[model samples]
Target: MGQQTRAHLTGRKIYGCGRCGTHLTTVEALLSKRFTGKFGQATLFYSVVNVLEGPPEDRRMTTGLHTVVDLRCLKCETYLGWKYIKSFEQSEKYKENCFLLERALLQTIEPGLELEGAEDPISREGNDSSTASNLQEEDDDDDDDDGDDEDE
Candidate 1:
């Protein structure tokens, strides 16, 4: 769940998974997208939330795999994406401190106070929103391999 403004939707703040919005650590969490082939090369995107335990499961695989852990919606268990547990590259180890959010799964939250009686806005489902489909991953990783290794 996150927000990265594209051309048409300029200056808009977005959030994802309405049920888990409260679980979000920051609206401005750094976003990173990369094909580590560890999580799925199609481009894994997620937002940095907080430090998490590097659980001792799903810990072995291809060389240079980012030691990342899967992050899920704390309430409903939706697979939001992964967070950096550690990195394999020493030069880029700072990435071990961010989250890579899936842009498609995200929705936008109004930047300021909600109008009276109005429900907090949620984006259309990823399958239905053209605007959302067009959203792109803006930030790049510091280039050391991203973090987190998935564990159930």
Candidate 2:
């Protein structure tokens, strides 16, 4: 086996997957914390890493109609949140191309701390279907609530 490539963020504070503790984004990428997600409070970020974007879906939110793609942790396939692809409302265009990470699904990783499961190169490959299935079961319940509230 070869050395695995890891994308670790260098910051005073880092946000990672709550389940897997894989680095997602840092405080520098944070845009706002007034957004809401399926689980409740969400945060807007300018960018994120180590995430997979699901298929885009049109959902009518309190702000307006938006096309968003759900984001999942690459290491654990945990449902983190979604990214706004297209915003129909002119006033809401600022959210386009922004990532929304659910606070409920994030864990704060302090500086100098090694990420959990960072050494397991197999997990980064994302080939474990069984593990993903189990971790996603609870998140599936939130899918029915498509009409999410607006982002402040």
Candidate 3:
């Protein structure tokens, strides 16, 4: 899921992996209502990633009934949360797109360059803030020199 939007949720971009600053998915695709258990207050949503479910030993997981899939960071391989293959409702079967939100976070689209595995995005002013600040300071110094010349 790249970008999702709901009629009610306008510009509500909920993200995960705030520390690593990785983009997982949005809240628009939430299927089930938010619940709490092994994970904190979490909800399920749709994901294009291969959502699988099983214990470590039984890795041959499938989207069978009552199966749980692990949601990982696409970049750092960090554990984000799990996904329910089926809906919590007994009647519903494998029809719902349910991905868990273990550590769901809110992210903003920073107006800057996008780099993979980057904690902080480079600002729009320039990729090198140090160089930009130095250039600004030099400009200030030039203004001071102009003032001094006028006085002379």
Model 2, 1-152: lDDT tens digits are 66445588888567778777799988777776667888777778888999989999999998999999999998778899999999999989988999998876776666666876443322445553423333245333433333434563
Across residues 6-99, which tens digit of lDDT does each residue of candidate 1 receive? 2121133444433334234333443334434322332333443322333433344343445767666544455655665766656546556456
Global fold similarity of model 1 (TM-score): 0.50
lDDT of 1 at 8: 20
**Model 1 misses residue 99 by how many Å?**
0.6
* Local distance difference test, each candidate: 0.42, 0.75, 0.40
TM-score of 3: 0.46
- Between prediction 1 and prediction 3, the one with superior lDDT is 1
Q: How close to the true structure is residue 83 of candidate 3, measured as C-alpha lDDT?
A: 60
Off by over 4 Å in 2: 1-5, 117-152
- Per-residue lDDT tens digits of candidate 3, residues 1-152? 57332111122443434334455554455454334424343444565242224352212223223555566555445565666554444554433445655433323323231424334423324443432233234333323221111000
Q: Say which candidate scores most in TM-score.
A: 2
Clashes of 2: 0
Q: Could you give the candidate ranking by lDDT, starting with the highest?
A: 2, 1, 3
